[model samples]
Target: MSTQLSEDEIIQKISGNDLTIGSCASQALTYIGNKCGYDVRDFRGADSRWLFGQYTTSQKIAEAGGFVECDYNGFKIADRLLRNVEEGKEYFYTSGEHAAIIRKTGKKFEYLETQSKHIDENGFHPLTVNVLKKRFRTTKTRKLEGEKFLQKEVLIETSKISDSPNFKELLGYLNTDPKNQKREVPK
Candidate 1:
């Protein structure tokens, strides 16, 4: 049985541990995938199958592996794409270097800083996305040979929204296309 975690439930589950270094992506994936009702099992993904390659439960992150099951991937957006983020939802985005969770609540964007060592009992430090974009800003913009430059690769665990009545509309709203800005794909 899959149980979706409420915001408070997620916070409570993660309050017991301190996030590790270089574990941002793992931590986010663990948080999203741990709610899938599987516990204490070895990961069967395409990754290496070692003794330590196990699917951690709850806020307990693997620190190295991103083993979550996602539906859509292999696309990126321009730097200006951040302006189009939808509200009242959480997103996991990465620039091929660092990763974090960006949540929009009531016209505000908050990101969970999992890379900070000072997170203490919270296991995360929630900050404004403006701070995140500034802190994680790259020295040079990642542009392709012509005009379509891929800035940051993005991913969304569509399994979380497969049952939505407006699934198709939601996917359309998340289009990262710069010009005309519409990509036909599963969300």
Candidate 2:
């Protein structure tokens, strides 16, 4: 199998994709789901928590099958997932304001700002939690942790978000047709 991207490389890969607002949810689902090997299927029906893309954001959504969740702002997710992150694992952090994927690298934690516009590079930023006091902050320097409790609301297991589809499946529409049907996606 091919080697995975180093953390630095992953930051570089997603830094300048030009994917901006309203795309965060979709981008999060696809990139994380693909990297973590989630099932990543399309969910369409009543009680469909699928966020964005419908017949709307066709190009992006088709490739990734849309970001599925009830809360786009992530208010519902943040309160539950942001605490108790352990080492060697990846987590998806969310709040009413923003969402990003975070992981542990030894004593420090790094995150991917997946939804920023290409020109605004907020990729692979680091965060340090004051676990002793139940608070966290973005570390500016090794010795300096910026602010306190800077509004991260929750964290979710990345692979557990198994419904996001992407990679070769990206940049086009999803192919959810019967196998017997003979046609390529996005024809």
Please, what is the TM-score per model?
A: 0.45, 0.44
Q: Where is model 1 more than 4 Å wrong at Cα?
A: 1-6, 15-20, 35-79, 115-130, 133-137, 142-151, 155-187
lDDT of 1 by residue, 1-187 (tens): 3466665455444322221223444445444443443211111222312211232321122112222321222122313434545676555555434555665566665666433323343333444444545644432344357543434344343244333354333222221222321111111
lDDT of 2 by residue, 1-187 (tens): 2346554444443333321223344445545544643333222211222333332333233233223233322333332344456687676554333345677777776766643334344455665333212222222212226433323244556554444544334422322223322222220
Candidate topping lDDT: 2
After best superposition, candidate 1 residue 165: deviation in angstroms? 19
User: Residue 62, candidate 2: how far off, in angstroms?
Assistant: 22
Clashes of each: 0, 7
